[model samples]
Target: MDTITTYLDSLFASLPDNDKTRQAKADMLANMRDYYRDLLREGKSEEAAIGAVISAFGSIDELRADLGMPAQATATTTQSDPTDAEEEADEDAITETELRSFWHMADQFATQIALGVLLCAVSIALPAYTGGGRWEGFGVIGMFLLAALAVGLFIWGGTVFSQQKKQLNDRPITASAKQLANKTTGEYTRQFAAGLIAGIMICIGSLIPPIISAYIPGFIIENAGGALFLAIAGLGSYLIIYVSINYSQLKRYAYATTAANSTAWYHDGTDDDAANYWEQPHKHHQNTRARQDIALFHQVYWPTVLIIYLLVSFLLHGWAYSWLIFIIGGVMQNIITAVIARRDYSE
Candidate 1:
């Protein structure tokens, strides 16, 4: 439905906004929706139905004449004598430098968040390593102290990142990294793959210490195993979160089209693949909606998981592999988001 609306917007963009035009536009949209539903009833795929609707839209120029409006000016005339308004719009478009400076900080922000989480995990182990009895109090105090420091890092990093996003914002991403940086799409894809593999490996390995400790038969084995598991799991999470968050934003910009974002640094018409160009606007819409939904989930989910983790780790005296809770939570979050996105956008 959004894709249909977006296409309708493009078809009517040049027309004046008034009572008759609005009525016509609404009628056109209704007709398009009816055709779309008929195609669906005939078992056509959503993509095929949308394509058919757009292909049959014919010429907006004819509609303009019917609406008592003048025909569009020739491209040659507009190109030869572009208006001041057009020049001002071009000037107002976001610069690549501003984009690079602002968006490239995702990695930094991810690192800060991951490191803070890792520190909290490490803080849990301090009490175990410091021994039992009265000395455990000191270790517990140290745990809180480290946790406090980790919280401070989180606050500071989040503040800076939020402020940057709020202040440096402009148009959405409009071009691939090739237009802004030296890296290619293949490079980023490879990087994402490598990071994913590494995170999985680390997470898998985190199970090793606890498994071995179970058979070793020693008192400290449990605490040591738990500490090791937490640390390793935290490290794995850092890699996954760091790469996923940064790569997500990077990708949104990389494949964005001029129709999706106003800041088209180097979009000339024939350069981009025709199919890719047509897909961009819809992809942009899907990504924006999915990102918002996932972000809202993150706000509630991760903090709650952290609180649960802290209570469990503290109460259980460093339960071996307790930190696996985090890894599992992340996996669940990913699966949930993936399912939601597929179900929501599949139509």
Candidate 2:
């Protein structure tokens, strides 16, 4: 148990400092450790336990796929001696240099996210201010500016998306990796656009009703208008979560693609049988199946929430019940998605 714990610690310590990556490594290590410990408890000897652990670790290809990381170098250089595990641990500690580099990259990403939020907020708010609280006038300008901002954000997001995809597709495969990459990239783009659309819809939906009520003489938009806006806001929030999850997956795909390509390039033409490209060990880890499953789940999940909201509205108070259900469903969906993501991507 002591030896296994030490081995696991060293394995995790060597991983890079990105939160997702680190969590993945830790989960993998923990799973591996438990498997080995179980074997030992079943009367396996030290030698047998070590061999079993190594075998269960599987190929680097499987690890990369399961952990949602890009393929790196092969396992051909792995150490066999149990003592070497401790040594690997000692060498795994992050250097100051590596930490600095990681922090720099993180800072840049944070800045970009902040800027995106600011742009979106300003774009949505500008029309209301310019329209002087008039519904019709505000709606037109808001739609234009919001749509423009959405397009701009989409373009920026697409650039990030492409870069990530290229990273994954660095090596040429027998069309499978490329095909998978293309599909995943397309899905991600659509999800992002959906999020932007939802945001625009929510902002417009919320503002328009209030403005209309204010302009009309006998109309009371406060109750119904508030409820509609709330519903829209709920939908918009769900879209944000939906987009983020897909984006994260896209990033993982990119990393995996890059790693697979690097591995393929390293071993190029080493054997004639390996020339199939897609059949290569590195390419085999591509998660086309998993991505499809996630996409299908997302499609159903959002619509389910919407339907529930609508049903609740009809069964109870039209406006009030609808918003209540929408808000509740949005919160629940976010929680479920977070759990699934952790389970799927972690180790």
Candidate 3:
């Protein structure tokens, strides 16, 4: 039995290592052993039974057809081995420089999120300062400055994020290495928690001054306290946004790298012989297309909402209810995204 299994292993050496090949090997080896045993029971000598079994096994060519192997792999070696090559390519491992680059980009992405929170904060404070017909000129000037800063930060953050994405798409680091970094980087998680804590504290602390000002009974003091409260809330929200977005991007990069590596292996033609190009590769591309479509929807939808908001608020002077458009658009966006996701999954 040992001798027969050894010979079977040698014969199977050239075949792909997959579920089908494994099962076929087991079936063939079992049949060969059974035939040998039956020959012995029929009064044949050991040597003759062995020789008969060896002869009956026939050529590797016939075995290949029986096992349903590809015609190109006729020898004890494949033209290209995806698994071996991929493992070799990761020999250099991930460098500290690559990790540093990812962190920098994550910080930049976080900065953009912070800027958005700042914009919201400024907007919240602006009306209180500008609306009561007091210091109207300075209030307008402050509003413009904050708005300009917010817009500038948003643009800068977008550019930085784009660069970060391009670097990932280029695959500067291996997927395994990225996974390792994510595991080792306790700082990302710590920072996320710290940011959340600080944001919550500031938000809670900001309420104290307003509560005291409520008893003072002066418009200036009360309004000042309200503005201070809004500012504090905005800063807290910004901190939360900054940490959360950066953490999410870190996760996204890790997953993207892993998926890309797997896709590359599958495309190498040796890793998955059981699946045709369409069954696996086409489905991946279909997912990519679905994501792109959803992204396009967001790109178009948000700008349209902004345009609608500005036109209605400035031209039609419907400031009170114009904001509902955003709520409606958000609901529609969610529905559209869900529909797209479901349709892709179904197909």
Candidate 4:
């Protein structure tokens, strides 16, 4: 019993500095130690006590199960080929983890794309709807509302950025878990900053077209307001593009982190059964392929679309068409960019 307790203590001492894993190990060790000590207090000889402890404790696989890890084997009374059962269990559990990681990757992709589309829609629609000069008081109210919303978003994004940064800076990325933690922190911070800056710029740029129209000559001002609106709209569109690009890049890193964390946890928990999971070896290759695919799409498709849209709008010589085309193109561009962005990390 004393020997068993000493063995568990040594194993616990060798575990890496992961808070949840460490606490779990500590609790399991303490429980085993107490149980064995109680056995020693009975009239058993040390050899008998140690044998009893070994039989009851089983192996690391049993300890993992006792600690509430997902059971790797079915409870079959026929103790035939327990080794095969362990392999099957490992395969099942690792597949579940991989599926979870895949779903999480999809979620991360959808979120960034949705946000980008929303930003484009809001930026384009706000100026066009308010440009007609009919809703005077309502326009002022809407501007304030938009400003408030932008500020609120910025504050939330900034908070996430700061927290992630602190977590990253405090830790050393010397292991797989630490590396994942740092990568996640960096990605979150980048996305938050991109969204924050883009939102503020769009809000401010949207207001410029209306304000400048009230000050110039009627002939000069008519075209001036529309031209200035288009210019600011173009700038806002560019900002959305920038945000989408950065968001796509950041989301890729986030996927890598999630995959790494899952792999690390699997390796840490599974003693000899870790070889069954395919996540660790394939992760890097998958992410690299994803990045290359995204880059190819971005480089080949986006610029051609943007150029054609701009050229057609210029040749048409109608303000309404120009405005409509710009708005539609901007929104479409953002959506396309967002979709491709997820592929950046898919490799």
Instruction: Quote model 2's TM-score.
Output: 0.33
Q: Per-model C-alpha lDDT, please? A: 0.64, 0.47, 0.60, 0.47
Give the count of colliding residue pairs in each prediction: 0, 5, 0, 5
In candidate 3, position 10 carries an lDDT of 85
Give, for candidate 3, the lowest lDDT window spanning 10 residues: 274-283
TM-score of each prediction = 0.59, 0.33, 0.50, 0.34
Error of 1 at 92 (Å): 5.4
Better structure of 1 and 4 per lDDT: 1
lDDT of 1 at 238: 79
Write out the backbone clash pairs for model 2. Answer: 70-255, 70-256, 168-257, 168-258, 174-278
Cα TM-score of candidate 3: 0.50
lDDT of 2: 0.47
List the candidate numbers ranked by TM-score, top first. Answer: 1, 3, 4, 2
lDDT of 2 by residue, 1-347 (tens): 56655655565454456755555555555555655665676688987887766654445464343333444323442323323322333232222233334334433443444344444544444443444455647656765776577567556765775564443333323223334544655666776667656754664565566566667845854444543444455445445544554555444433232223333333322223123222332222223333444667789988988887777677765753254454445445545654554444332
Q: Give RMSD to native, each candidate.
A: 9.4, 15.6, 15.4, 17.9
Could you give candidate 4's per-residue lDDT for residues 1-347 as a string of tens digits? Answer: 45775776665454455665566555555545544565566567778766755554445554444333555432331243433323433232323233335335434443444344344444444554566677645655655665566455545654654454343321111123324434654756666567646744774575566565666456335544654554455455555544554444344334442232233233434333233122232333334445565567668665766676677777765433344454445446545654654554342
What lDDT does candidate 3 reach at residue 313? 98
Residue-wise C-alpha lDDT for candidate 1, range 1-347, written one tens digit per residue: 79989988987898778765677677667667866786686689999999977775545664553344443323332243222323323343444565677666767887888788888878887886666656788889989998998899899989988887765343444343225532533467688778878987998898888788887777447777867877887788778877766665565454333332222212232223222333444454455556667778889989999998898899986655566777668656766766655553443
